[model samples]
Target chain A: MTVTPDQVLDCSGLACPMPILKTKKAIDSLQIGQILKMTATDPGSKSDIDAWTKKTGHELISYEQAGARYIFYIKKTK
Target chain B: MGETSKRLAIIAAHGSLDAAYPPFILATAAVAMEMECAIFFTFFGLEILKKGYADKLKIAPIGNPAMPVSIPNIVGVLPGMTSMATGMMNGWMRKAHVAKVSELLNIALESGVRFIGCQMTMDVMGYKKEDLIDGIEIGGAASFLEFAGENAITMAF
Candidate 1:
């Protein structure tokens, strides 16, 4: 299924908690079914975002590494 | 489902005044992110939320091995020493761009962070509801756990 884009959050170079915090702020501004594209450079971003998505009940549509950057697609679930 | 908002819960159980700073700092930062934040104060941590003791809180250096050797332990054992050290530390923090505990607490409250006092601890310490700061909610561990469960982040200090 195709997901609709809602917002994009570029969080590269941000350390632990900042990325998560910014992603959260972005998600809060979006409505249900909207998707967010998040990019970050923190080594812990992958696991932190994944865990955050799980705990917050958000849907992590996709995640992949592009060179040194980690990109994630998250959907507002609840 | 609607957008899942980030929420956080911080449990502060330390009796030492300096130790209380971490929980408030994290809570205030969480508030800055506009996340729903709650601080659960338990045990000696309740002192900071007590109206009578809050402003008089002092940083205890006794038994703290990391204490600078320049400050003699004997001096630390003297009356008013902890308060003097706390005041000096507060001044240094202000110079170093670090936020004070009271400032952080105020910011956290203004930013919508919930502050809760542990009911069990209050009873054990003989504190009535009037003894606590205004707007402080009284609850037990189960209540805090319920709030923490819905939060994406949980911290203990």
Candidate 2:
């Protein structure tokens, strides 16, 4: 499948809380309805992003595992 | 849901001297985000909310394998050492511009963050309402469970 990006956030090698923190910052800078593509290597990224999106009312478009990294596509809801 | 507000509850259970930082840091962060935050102090965690105990608490190195070798492992065993260490640590934090426990508590209060003391813990510790600091609401686990319900983020520190 083809992936189109609106914004890219590389959060590899970051620890717990930081990945979420950076993601929030990235999403905050974008306009509503704009997409955010985040790449993280933290093992907790998958669950953290999942929980964060659920809690923050954001939409998770897709999540893919690439080699040792995890990538996510998200849309700003608020 | 049409609400834009964030609500969180931090369960402070570790009565360790240094363990107080988790709830304080997280609560302060919540306040920074303009979120409604609450800290429920249970068991030994209530020590931090005491009038003078917050300034008198210390991080015990006993049973802590991660402690540096220069610091004596038995420092916690010595009487008054905990208070001394707590004082020193507080001073260092001040020098480093880190927020004080009292400051954080005040900030939480000012930001409208609720502070709840665990009734069961207070009973176990032989403390009364007057034994704790002012402005604390006494409640049981069920109360906190209710407060943590309905999508509110809950964390045990």
Candidate 3:
């Protein structure tokens, strides 16, 4: 499925905990059911974001890797 | 707001620059995971809460063999070794895009991660509430345990 995000956040060049922190802050501004497209350069973000999605009950529509950037399509739930 | 069921409780017992990152990083990450988080600063860890202390924290290389640059114990004990070690680590962190400890501390506070200063430690150290950054609640072990409660993942740094 092609998921279009309602908002985009760039966490490039930030290390662990920062991408997650910024992602949380950005997602907080979006409405429930809206999607956030987050791009991160940290390699650890793959597992971290998945774990965050699982713990927070947010939906991870899809994730892609473009060169050094890891892109995530996240949908806010509740 | 109805939050998640998980929680994180951190006991920060060290104040050295190398030892300071874990609690703040874990607490903030736990918050982003939608978990309740609190950090209790005791003993040396209380130094992290002092206003303007982050910039001055030092990493002693003598005891730390894993420092990016290995130094002989004798050499590491020389004057200014701690300063040099701290500077080198700071440079590495900057290159790695890691946020400063001060910045992480602010993120934790702004994100609602609870910070509890040990009241007895403050008393022993002659630290007044004004000596610490604002928004931290002063309390003792019992107070922190009360906040940690049950079912929270507990860790110490």
Which candidate number has the best lDDT? 3
Candidate 3: regions farther than 4 A off: B1-5
At residue B142, what lDDT does model 1 achieve?
A: 87
lDDT of prediction 2: 0.77
- TM-score, chain B, each candidate: 0.85, 0.84, 0.95
Interface RMSD of each: 6.1, 7.1, 0.5
Q: Is the docking of candidate 3 incorrect, acceptable, medium or high quality?
A: high
In terms of lDDT, the poorest run of 10 residues in model 2 chain B is B62-71
Error of 3 at A76 (Å): 1.3
Q: Candidate 2: where are CA atoms >4 Å away?
A: A1-78, B1-5, B72-84
- Best candidate, TM-score-wise? 3
**Chain A TM-score compared with the true chain A, each model in order:** 0.93, 0.94, 0.95
List model 2 lDDT by residue over A8-78, tens digit each.
99988765545676687788889999999999988878998887787777899899999989999989888
Judged by DockQ cut-offs, the docking class of candidate 2 is: incorrect
Worst 10-residue lDDT window, candidate 3 chain B? B1-10
Report lDDT (CA) for all predictions.
Answer: 0.78, 0.77, 0.91
